[model samples]
Target: MTLLTKLKKSNINRSEYLFLENKLAFLTTEVVENKYRNSKLVIGLLGFVSIGLVLVVLWMQRKRKGLPIVGLSRQERNIQGLILQGKSNKEIANELFISISTVKTHITNIYSKLHVSGREELLQKLQN
Candidate 1:
């Protein structure tokens, strides 16, 4: 009824039959391996594409908002916003639970990114 049954019933030499059986097993194993490899490749590509899409969407949204400090990290952006609201570095440090020096560091990074010399210039730049 099956291929193997027919082979067994046929008048084939033992060596030839054994060779054919081994070849069939080898082919089956190859097919399974190929399928596994293909699925892994597909999954990897999908993950890469999904990450790229998310980044693009975020960039588009940020651009649409016309945020002045586009290049600032989230922490730096928070510092800049607080500065705009007339909060001193010490207040920002207390509110954000960071050291005063850490707040100063974020402010410096924000100033460097926004090309502002000080809080006054930063305020002027963002207000316009």
Candidate 2:
């Protein structure tokens, strides 16, 4: 009762039937390939959008907290906090188990990032 069955029962030539069968196979393959490609594209887009949303939420949270220093490294922030608590370079180095020179270097970087020349100015900047 199908079209192919009716065609086979009719006076269709052998070559014509073969051609129609091959064309149908090719169209089916093309449709499956298109669907596969579209699914991959949709999945990739969703991943990209999810990452963007997470980054936006993190930025908003940081902004809401009113952070004073924006670009300080973790180590630098730790040094800044120690400095705020009136810890000297040698004491900070002893507590953190780092060399005094390394502690000094982190302090220098912190000062540069905060645009403060020394600890006093850094404290003043953070307080206000």
Candidate 3:
């Protein structure tokens, strides 16, 4: 036998050795089970937090209802204001010191952003 086992055999009685061994085994099993349970709880909590954060971000990103003006840039907002005042594209171009094509492009971008096909539709949508 090894020196350690020979020492244990000399120092410890059979009943005492068996009781110590059983206690150690029980304690080790309890530790393993507790660790497993703790790790699972931590993982489950992290999963819920991750999903909750994703849901909050998605909720915040949703498009605002009733007022589409928030989506327009300053220049686009200016163009929209002029359009509301019954100005023609040429008039808007001259007033804004931009080319007529630039005005048309702005108007097109505004139309797309506002989801309108024409000036009348734009006015009607903005009214509601």
Candidate 3: deviation at residue 91, Å?
3.8
Over 4 Å off, model 3: 1-10, 63-74, 94-97, 111-125
Runs in model 2 with CA error above 4 Å?
A: 1-6, 67-127
Minimum summed lDDT over a 10-residue window in model 1 is located at 62-71
Error of 2 at 29 (Å): 0.7
How far is each candidate from the true structure, as Cα RMSD in Å? Answer: 9.3, 8.3, 4.5
Model 2 lDDT per residue over 15-34, tens place: 99988878878998999999
Q: What TM-score fits each model? A: 0.49, 0.47, 0.68
Point to the candidate with the largest TM-score: 3
Q: Give the Cα error of residue 68 in candidate 3, in Å.
A: 4.5
Off by over 4 Å in 1: 67-128
| lDDT values, one for every candidate | 0.88, 0.89, 0.87
